[model samples]
Structure formats: C-alpha cells, structure tokens
Target: MNKIKAYGTESHKDDLKEMTIERRDVLENDVKIDILYCGVCHSDIHAAKNDWGNSKYPLVPGHEIVGKVVEVGSAVKDYKEGDIVGVGCMVDSCQECQPCENDLEQFCEKGMVGTYNGKNKHTGKQTFGGYSTTVTVREEFVLKVPTNLDTKAVAPLLCAGITTYSPLNHWNVKKGDKVGVVGLGGLGHMGIKFAHAMGAETIMITTSPDKAKDAKRLGADDVIISKNEDEMKKHKNSFDFILNTVPVKHDINPYLNLLKIDATMCMVGAIEPLEPMNGGNLIMGRKRVAGSLIGGIKETQEMLDFCGEHNITSDIEMIDMQDINTAFERVTDSDVKYRFVIDMDSLK
Candidate 1:
C-alpha cells in the first residue's frame, strides 16, 4: 500500500478535511494514475452525507476523475506511463456475470464496485476515490482521456457525459428528431450537447428563465420555460424523446404530457421518491418512462473517443481542494453554472 494525500469527510456532520489514505500498490493488472482534476458530482455530496443510506465514513467522494498514468503494472498491455487517462463511477465488478459478459457491467448481477464508499472485491476493504493525489485501478477500468480536450472540462465526462450519452445512443436519437432535455444542470447540459451533436432539433426545458441564454450557448436550438402553460402546450405530443435530468422531487406529469404517442422519456436524475402521476398520463399517449445510469467501461471509452472527435466537453469551474465545502454548498443550491472540478495539485 502507498499513502496519498486526500480530502474527505470523517462523519455525517463534519466538513471535508485533509487526510492520508492508503492506495493499493500497482499489481500486475493495475494502472496507477496521478489525479489532475476530479469533477464534483451530486452523488458525491449525497454519498458523503449518507443521503443514500449506504455511505462509509471518511468518504473521499469523487468519481469523474481525469489524470495521467504515472505507472503501469507489468501485465498491463493497454496502458503505459505518461498516458492521459480517467476513472469513472465503477472500479470493478464480477466479470463472470451475464451483464458483464454483455458489456453492461453497470448492471452486474453481483454488485459492481463503486469508485468510493464501496467494497473492494479483491481486498474486501472500503474503496476511496479521486479526491486524492493518486489512484491505482485495474487496467480494464482505466479509460483513455482525449488529449485534445481540456483536462478540467473532460473530468465531468466520466460520469455526466456517459450518463447522458448512453440513453441518447440507446434510443437512437438522430437527425431531424425533436429532443427535449429537462433541467439544465450537469447531466442536462451534456444531454443537450449530445442531442444537438446527433443532429436532433434539441430543446432545453427548464423552469428557470435565466437559463435560456446558457442553454442556447450549450447547443440547445431552443429553450422552453416549462412553467409556462402556453410554451408547454406548443410542444405537446411533438418530442421524439425527452431526457429528464432534474434531480429534485416534482410533478412529472407535465413532462409526460409533452410526449408524442409511443414516445419515450428517460430519467437520469430524481433518485428520491417523486410525487405520483396519473396513469392516464401514460395510457392515453403510450408514453414510456425509463431510467439510466452511466455507461459501461467500453461505452465510456467510446464516449471519450466521440467527445474527442466532436470537441465536446463540459462547462466547468475549477476549484482547489480547500474550497470543497463551499463547492458542496454551491452545488446543493444549484448555484454552479454547470460542474466543479478540483485541481489535485492543491492536495500535493
């Protein structure tokens, strides 16, 4: 084991503070990363506060990691030292499962190992994440970062990018299709970018009027203030697909009513219990509601490659390790323009 500096929360009530944590030494299949920028994901805050009811203490909460390979295990063939790389939400999973066999390891029948606040399959100890100076991951889980993209901006792609990309790719969004993206937060921004890139007539649906300009700047062809009945009515039964990225508990019926017959709306947020909706909302139009997690490792790498091809990356505000607490509060209040990325040099 090797000691590394990290920032983590010690208890439910405590703020994040500097600490030394042990990272596993490079094994035959391990790739060691010198973390450069780690994106702040909402789930990190949720996990740190035990909002999911499954957090482990001294939690180092970060998953959207971008770094450079500093070392590679002897058996590692795909990666070498000095490569730009990244790690996402998952570190390991039982590769024997049916889901894993199909490259759907995110749905592993045996629980997939999370980057942080999760059990390590090999050591049987709690795993920490990218809030540290370095991490050693199995080569299969380490992704190549596109050299053309800015490292800070690419950080959010590990989670937010893949989370949005998977659903768009699965539903086969294409040219001339009308795509609606609900909520203009981290996930929603990526959804808009991907949908627009797919040649869809992308629309940003949000409650905030202030987000109109920002949405258009992020590739949204149009912006709809969802609270306005007239605006909502104009688009009713028109969207080919709607990707919902709103995280708060709210009435979803309005969005449901906007779907065309046999149209689908995929939910990537709203992890909490939501207000009930009328079943007639679905029965009448044949609308469907679904949820998606981040893409599998293979798909995640594909997302990075696609981003590289398209020059797509997140809008990020870089922060130092010392401002993590402030960043958390800003995130909770929806005060950030998009995403926050931590510069690991501060940890050093």
Candidate 2:
C-alpha cells in the first residue's frame, strides 16, 4: 500500500480538505495511474452530501478520471508506462455474471464496484476515486484515451460523456431522426451533441428561452420552449426519440406528449421518484419511456474513439484542486457554464 495525497470531506457537512489516503499496490492485472485531471460531476456533490443515502464519509468523490500510466503489472499487456488512460464510475465487477460476459459490466449481477464509495472486490477495502495524485485499477476497467483531443477537457467523457452516449448508441439513433434533448445541463448538453453528430435533427427542449442561443451553439438544430402552449402543441407527436437529462423530479407528462407513436423517451437523469404520469399519454400513442446507466468499459472506449474522431469534449472550466469546495457550491447553485475539472498537479 502507498499513502497518496488527496482532497475529501470527512463529514457530510464539512468542507473538503487535503488528506492522505492509501492505494493498494499494483496487482498482477492492475495499472497505477498518475492522475492528471479529474472532472467535477454533479453526482460528486450528491455523493459528498450523502443525498443518495448510501455515501460513505471521508469520501473522495471524483469518477471522471484522466491520467498517465506510471506503472503496469506483469500481466497487463494492453497498457504500458507513459500511456494515457482513464477510469469512470466503475472500477470492478464480478466477471462471472452474464452482464460481464456480455461486456455490460456496469450491470454486473453481483454489483459493480464504484470508483469511490464502493467496496473493493479483492481487498474488501473502500475504493478511493480520482480526486488524488494517483489510483490503481484493474486493466479491464481502465480505458484507453485518445491522444488527439484536449486531454484536460476529455475527463468529463468518462462520466457525462458516456452517460449520454450510451442511450443514443443503444437506441440506434440515426440520420433524420427528430430527437429531443430535454434540459440544458451537463448531461443534456452532451445528449444534443451526440444526437447532432449522429445525424439526427436535434432540438433543445427547455423552459428558458435564454438558453436557446447557447443550445444552438452546442449543436441543437432548433429550440422548443416547453412552457409555450402553442409551441408545445405544435411539436406534439413529432419526435422520434427524446433523451431526458433533467437531474431533479419534474412532470415528464408534457415531454411524453411530444413523442411520436412507437417512439421511446429514455431517462438518463432524475434518479428520484417523479410525479405520476397520465396513462393515457402512453396508452394512446404506444410511446414508451425507459432508463439507462453509464456504459460499460467496451462501450466507453467506443465513445472515446467517437469523441476523438469528431473532436468532441465537454465545455469545461479548469480549477485547482484546492478550489473543489467552492466548485461544489457553484455546481449546486447551477452557476457553471457546463462542467468543472480539477488539475491534480495543484495538489503537489
């Protein structure tokens, strides 16, 4: 084991502070990463505050991690020292499960180990995430990052990028499909970019008219103010697919009304319970609603490859590790333009 420098909150209500944590020695199938950048996800704030009720204290909450490989175990043939790599929301899963066999380890039947706040399958110790100087992960769970894109901006792709990319790729969204990306936050922004890049006529569905211009700049082909009665009615039953990225509970019935018969709307956000929906909305049109989690390792690599090809990366603001507490506050207040990433060198 090695004591590594990191920043984490000791209590739910306490501010994040500098601390030292232990990382296991590299195992036969493991790779040790010198973490360069880690994205600040909204879920990080949620975990830090124990909002989901499963958070463990002294939490190191970053999952969107990007860095360079400093060491590789003898059995790790796919990665080498000096190679760029990444780790997302998951670090390990039971490989015997059907999901794991199918390359969908995110749905591992035995429960996938999270990057942080999860029990390590091998050591039975709490996993520390990427808000630190280094991390050691299994080769299968580690990702090969494309060197072509902006390394700093590429960190969010591990979480926000893959979270939005999975649903679109699974649904096989294609050319000329009229796709609606609900909300304009981190997830929603990536949804728009993916839908547009996939050749769909992407529309931004939001309550704020002021966001329309910014949404267009992010690849949205058009804007629909959901609060406008005439505008909502005009586009009713016209969408081929809708990706709902609203993080909080709200009435989804209206968004339901915008889908075409036989089309589906997938929820990638708002993990909480939502208000009851009118059954008629779905029964009458045969429209469907579904949910998706982040993609598995194989698919995450694909998303990274796609991003590399298209030069896609999140709109991010860079911050020193010391400012993470303030960054958390800004994220809670919805004050950031999009996402925040920490430069781990600041900790040195």
The residue-by-residue lDDT of candidate 1 on 1-348, one tens digit each, is: 888899998897899999989998789999999999999999999988889888889899899999999999999999999999999999999889999998988999998999999897768788999999999899999999888998889999999999999999989999989999999999999999999999999999999999999999999999999999999999999999999999989899999988999999999999878899889999998899999989899999999999999999999999999999999999999989799999999989
Clashing pairs in 1: none
lDDT of 2 at 238: 97
Question: How close to the true structure is residue 88 of candidate 2, measured as C-alpha lDDT?
Answer: 98
Candidate 2 whole-model C-alpha lDDT, 0 to 1: 0.94
Off by over 4 Å in 2: none
| Overall lDDT per candidate, in order of appearance | 0.93, 0.94
**Candidate 2 lDDT tens digits, 213-235:** 99999999999999999999999
| Residue 255 accuracy (lDDT) in model 2 | 93
TM-score of each: 0.99, 0.99
Error of 2 at 168 (Å): 0.5
